[model samples]
Target: MSTPPESRQEAIARLSRSASDLEARTTRQLSHEAAGQKAAGQAWKIIADLFGGVFVGLALGFGIDYFAGTTPVGIIGGVLLGFAVSVWMAWRTAQRLMAEAKQHGEPQSVPFDDDEDQGA
Candidate 1:
C-alpha cells in the first residue's frame, strides 16, 4: 500500500497552533516573572525604609549620648522616636501601595485573623 503524501495545510495548521501555544506560555511566564520581581523590589524597599529609620535614629541617639553624657536616656529616646518613624514610614508605604492597587483596579485586600484570642 502506497503511503499518502503529508498534507501541507495540516502541517501549517499544526505549526501555527504550536507557535500560538508557545507565545502564550512565554507571555504568561514573563508576566509572572515581572510580577515576582516587582514584589521582591517592593519588599526590599519596605525593609530598607523600616531599618533605615531605625539605624538613623540609633546613630543620632548614640551621638547625642556620647556628647551629652546622658547615657541610656538619649539612646532610649532615639530608639523610641526611630520606632515611631519606622511605623509611620511603613504606614505611608502601605497607603501608597494600596492607592496604586486601587488605581490598577486590583484593589488588594489582606485578611486578618482574630480567632486566636477567642480560642484562648
Candidate 2:
C-alpha cells in the first residue's frame, strides 16, 4: 500500500529535484556572467596598456632629462612623441567605439561620416 504524493516523503523528493535544477541553472548563469566580465576586462587591459605605455614613455623621458639637466631637447622630444602616439591611440579608440555602436544598430554617428550633408 503506497501513500499519495501529498505525503511528506513524496513532497520532499519533488522539492529536492527542483532545488537541484535551480542550482544547475544558477551555476550556468554565473559562469556566463564571469566570462562576459573577463572579456570586458581583457578589452580594457588592451586600451590601458596603450595609454600606460604612452604615460610611462613620457614620464621616464622627462625624469631622465631633468636629472641629466638637459632642458628642452630630451624632455620636449619625449613629450612630442608621447603626445603624438596618445592622439593617434585616441583616434583609433574613437573609431572602434563608433564601429561598435554601429554594430548595435544604433543611430548614425555623424562625425564618423564627414561627407554627410549636415543642413543645420
Candidate 3:
C-alpha cells in the first residue's frame, strides 16, 4: 500500500534541504577545482622560469661567441652558468612555496618510512 502524501509544508522543507545539500556539494566541488587550477598555474610558472633561464643563457652565450670569436667556450660556459642559476632560483622558489604552504596550513606529503620498507 502507498503511504499518505506529505503535507505542503513538509514538501517545501524537503526541497529546501535538498537545495542546501546541492549548494554545499557544488561549493565544495568548485573550491576543489580552483585549488587544482592554482596548483597547475604554480607548476607552469616554475617550468617557465626554468626554460626562460636556459633560453636567456643560450642567447647571451651565442651573442658573446659571435662577437668575441670564442665559439665553443662561450656557449658552454653560458649554458653551465644558466643551468646553475636556474637550479638555484628553482630551489629558492620551492622553499618559498613550501613556506607559504606551511603558513596556510596546507597538507603536506607524508615522509617515507624506512621501517615500513624494511619490514616488507
Instruction: Estimate the overall C-alpha local distance difference test score of candidate 2.
Output: 0.71
Worst 10 residues of 3 by lDDT: 108-117
For candidate 1, the 10 contiguous residues with the lowest summed lDDT are 107-116
lDDT of 3 by residue, 18-92 (tens): 999889867766776787899899888888878888888888899999999999988888888888888888888
Q: Which stretches of candidate 3 lie over 4 Å from their true place?
A: 106-120
By summed lDDT, the worst window of 10 consecutive residues in model 2 runs over 108-117
Instruction: Report the Cα lDDT for residue 10, model 2.
Output: 80
In TM-score terms, which candidate is top? Answer: 3
TM-scores of the models, in the given order? 0.77, 0.53, 0.81
| Candidates in descending TM-score order | 3, 1, 2
Q: On a 0 to 100 scale, what is the lDDT of residue 79 in model 2? A: 69
Q: Which scores greater on TM-score, model 1 or model 2?
A: 1
Model 2 misses residue 20 by how many Å? 0.9
